[model samples]
Target: MSQPLTGVKVLDFSTLLPGPLCSLLLAEAGAEVVKIERPRRGDEMRSYEPRLGEDSANFVLLNRGKRSIAIDLKAPDALERLMPLIREADVLIEQFRPAVMDRLGLGYAALSAANPRLVYCSITGFGQHGPRAQEAAHDLNYVAASGTLSLTAGSDGAPVLPPALIADIAGGTYPGLVNILLALRQRDQTGRGAHLDVAMADNLFTFQYWGLGNGALGQWPGTGTDLVTGGTPRYQIYRTADGAFLAAAPLEDKFWQRFTELVGLDAAALDAMPPPQATEAVRAAIARQTAAHWEQRFAGQDVCTCRVVGLEEARRDPHFGARGLFSRTVATATGERMAALPVPIDAAFRATDATLPSPALGADNPLLDH
Candidate 1:
């Protein structure tokens, strides 16, 4: 069966995380993604550690199934060379700072003239024409600037770094992908295109919708002091006797009651407002047994409890194996095969290619010909 995006073409002029990730999803959905990279050096992610062939494993994983074309935008003929692809492309993703594309004559205005149906997306730390539009930042900076980082904390009451790139993936890549698809749908109806400005920092606020409403009510949650952020006995992590952690989130009253019963705690302990003592009691009870013991005890219960396993353990679990997530593979330069990075797209929209490889630099540069 043909995929939904089987005929869509994407010109990816972005490097590193957000834009490349977005284009990767498009490619997985059967879009023809042609990555435009800097000449000679290619994407900087190729320099990242733990080499796979000549490029980093990170680069190989993120760029699998996409073709590459190396070109120096500063060169006089660069625009001319890219014009064909730009006109043919249905979607274009770029992450340069504001006005940088204009300097190279590749801004939305210039490209839209050549292809009126182009859905051009710009991913940045701050949006175009903002006070901090040109300010250099990464995932951490975007989270900090958005106030979402303040919600991350431990018992020490100090803010903890997030385990993932919250801003890059959740904010930029996801929003860019969603808006690009929406713009394409709108074009189908209106016979026009859109220039989307996706700012990672601005988009991070959507993750804090609850916090925003709380602030509107003059009840803003502080660091580590909210229902979902480790403040309540109903939703907190407790250490087992074996030193592993059990993440429990029985937020509803029924589940909380079941959790308290299973943990051998007095249900009234949590009924007291601002449950510091109740939380400590819950912690003490959990610490009395190993994670395995609690796993058995909590099994088949309404209490949402599970042991926190390491990445390797999680990957090797039977559940994920049964789901066929790792059935698709990408090969290293040496032909060593591993699971492909799991994409969020439904498998029905992706080809059943058993294995794919990342393209060599400029491997598809011959596309320039008429």
Candidate 2:
């Protein structure tokens, strides 16, 4: 079966999480994504240790379903080789610091002149024109700048970095891809490309809708009291007796009522308690039972809750497995089987049962004439 993005070519000059992830999505959707990396060393992420082999799991995961072209961007011959490829590309994505592309002569003004219909996207920690645009930063810095760090961790506990780079993935990668696709659609009608500047920090504020709303309305409470950030009893995690954990988010009254009933809460106990006290009581009750006990008790209930799962447990989850959430495919470089990326379009499009892999370094540069 033919894919929707077949024949579309993407030149990926992004590295690390955000840029590569965006292009990976394009590749999964059937676009031919050529990842342009620095010569010799390649992507810095590939050297991340703690994995079992030469290939870093992070690099393998993000770079799947795309081709790699290792080149020295500073070299004169490199730009000449890339210019021809740029002329035929539908999209060009980069995550360098502001004006780095312009310095290399591959900036939007330079490249779009060669291909008017090309969608040029630049992802950065801060926006292109911001006061901090030239500052060197990473995911932690971006989240901190966006004010997202204040809403993280518990009140008494030290502010902690999230397990995921929410700013990079949600703000930078996903938004970049979405805008690039929108630009492509607009170009289809107008025959003109667009230059998109996606800032990782800007989207952080947008992701914190509840917090932002409160700040705007002058009703946003202090750090630990916010509704969605573990403030209320209805949406929090509780530790169990066996050292495991269970997550409950019964936001609606019906679900909360069901939760209280399942836990056998008395009317007097419920009436006399504040939200925090109620949460503490619930936590104490949960701590009395083992995780397995709660899992059995909640089996048939319609409560909006479940156990807190780690990466390994999530991989084996029946619900996700049934839906083909972590489908496997073979890598073209080493023929190694690995989990395919999870990106659902609609019911008509099956995200699983399709085999595609990341390209070996510079594998597709020879196919330039095609």
Candidate 3:
């Protein structure tokens, strides 16, 4: 089947996670992506630990199926060298702070003038015009400022760092991908492109929609006090006898009733007791049994409870294998295989062949000489 973005050309000027991952999705969907990196050092991610051949594992995972062109945008004739690629590209994405591209004379105004139908997207920590637009931040800071971090607290009631880069992938990459596709659709009709300003911090509030709605109504349940944040007995992690954990989230009444029964809880007594006492009772019961015991008991059940597996276990899970989540692999320069980073794009739109490895730094520089 023909891919959705088979003819689209993307010029990716972003680095690290957000921009690279977004362009990876575009490439998986059959867009031709050319990643522009610094002349020698390339993306900083190439130097991240756990190297795979010539680049880091992270760089290989995020940058598969893209061509590379190295250029010093600060060079006097940089614009002259980039003009051909710009004219041919349907999309351009950058992750610099506000006005950086403008200062380089490669801003949307200049690019769009050269190619009126180019979709120019800028992904930044904050919106282009915000008070904190130029402030430095990473995934942690963005989630912290958006109040998402406060919702995830440790047992001692202090906010904990999240295991995932929610703000980077959910806030920046997904929004950038969605908006770029939307701009392409708009261009199909109007024959004109748009400048997309995707602010990572601004997009994070959507992840806390439930809490935000409650806050707006003046029913804010303080940090870590909400239903899904360990406030109730029915929806929280419980320690097993083996010291492993089970994530129990039987929120609906039917599932909750089944879970309480399975754990030997007297539902009537639990209802009459204080919530904290009920929670403690459930925890105590869960701690009496091994995680393996609960894993077996909950098999084929719709209780929304399961053993908390480690990253390696998750990678080897039968369910994920059945879904073909880790079926794709990319070859390193030395021919060693590594799992391709998974994206949410559907199989119908994804390329079927093994993806190309991340390019060597400036491997496609000869194209610029033309």
Candidate 4:
């Protein structure tokens, strides 16, 4: 229960993936998060498919360690009732469309006036400013704008939508968490809070650092041809027999040599194979064997290769188990154990217990009344 953010209070006015996840990370680190929802339905994510009893797994996973308060933001006295909580909050997060907060008279300018040291974070698809600032968008749209989606599809195929919401969580949620903590640190030094504009599109661009940074400097031509982005034969995925996969990430010469040797590929073959050709060649080599055979063939080798595993297989992987990746806790509602946080703060870092049961809606009574 002890952590760096133990005494901090966070006001969460966000819903779904990005905003809720940001606050959940803070709460997991021991901050007190109060999620403000609509009076009637609360967050729409509560009803997402694949329910764990009455609550969705998506909702329970993202909303753990936070308290929820259902409030009518449009009411005449809504702002008045929220002002007291705002005054005590160290951080305020919202992910509504660009003018939504201002329309409700609860914009950053208004709330920050009540608490000068409040770290006001706004998460959006585009940003607070720009030609497309007010336009509505989803994860795919944001990643497309940032050039991430185009480079992430199968070779010579149309871009495929990824299963994960990278734009929302990696772009919006992570940046929001980092900036909120930074704003809090700045407040400690200067006694002032700063406004944070976290756009999923902008964050996606930042996330593609190896691509954007090198491409802009003319070191890389951009697109999937870059070394790390499917440009190199040494760092791509190849299909095995039965359509299973083997991942090759041997960037160094030594590792690549070992990988080629194991696959019975001549060293000269690597020089002749671009990513596309190499991928096909590797696929052919792998297709000669089953996944289990390749796994055994590649084991104890320093070629940076492994079998591509699905979620269930990954959860039960020996390496993940050895590293203590997936700790378990029983959910209060379902009593079914689920994976807990994966971040391990070492002894040198602050170690807070993140094993508490997830909050039922408005579980913290005192925070709701204020």
Q: State the lDDT of candidate 3 residue by residue for 223-255, as single tens digits.
A: 546788887888888999999999988888888
**lDDT of model number 2:** 0.81
Model 4 lDDT, residue 286, Cα? 79
How displaced is residue 282 in candidate 3, in Å? 0.4
**TM-scores, all models, native as reference:** 0.97, 0.93, 0.98, 0.91
Q: Worst lDDT window (10 residues) for model 1?
A: 330-339
Tell me the whole-model lDDT of each prediction, alpha carbons only.
0.90, 0.81, 0.91, 0.80
Q: Mark the regions of model 2 whose C-alpha exceeds 4 Å error after superposition.
A: 50-54, 267-272, 345-353, 367-370
Quote the positional error of residue 12 for candidate 2 in Å.
Answer: 0.4
Q: Deviation in angstroms for 150 in model 3?
A: 1.2
> What does each candidate score in C-alpha RMSD?
1.2, 2.2, 1.1, 2.5
CA lDDT of 19 in candidate 4?
94
Clashing residue pairs found in predicted model 1: none
| Better TM-score candidate (3, 4) | 3
For every model in order, what is the number of clashing pairs?
A: 0, 1, 0, 0
Displacement of residue 292 (Cα, Å) in model 1 is 1.3
Q: What global local distance difference test value does model 1 have?
A: 0.90
Runs of candidate 1 with Cα error greater than 4 angstroms are: 332-336
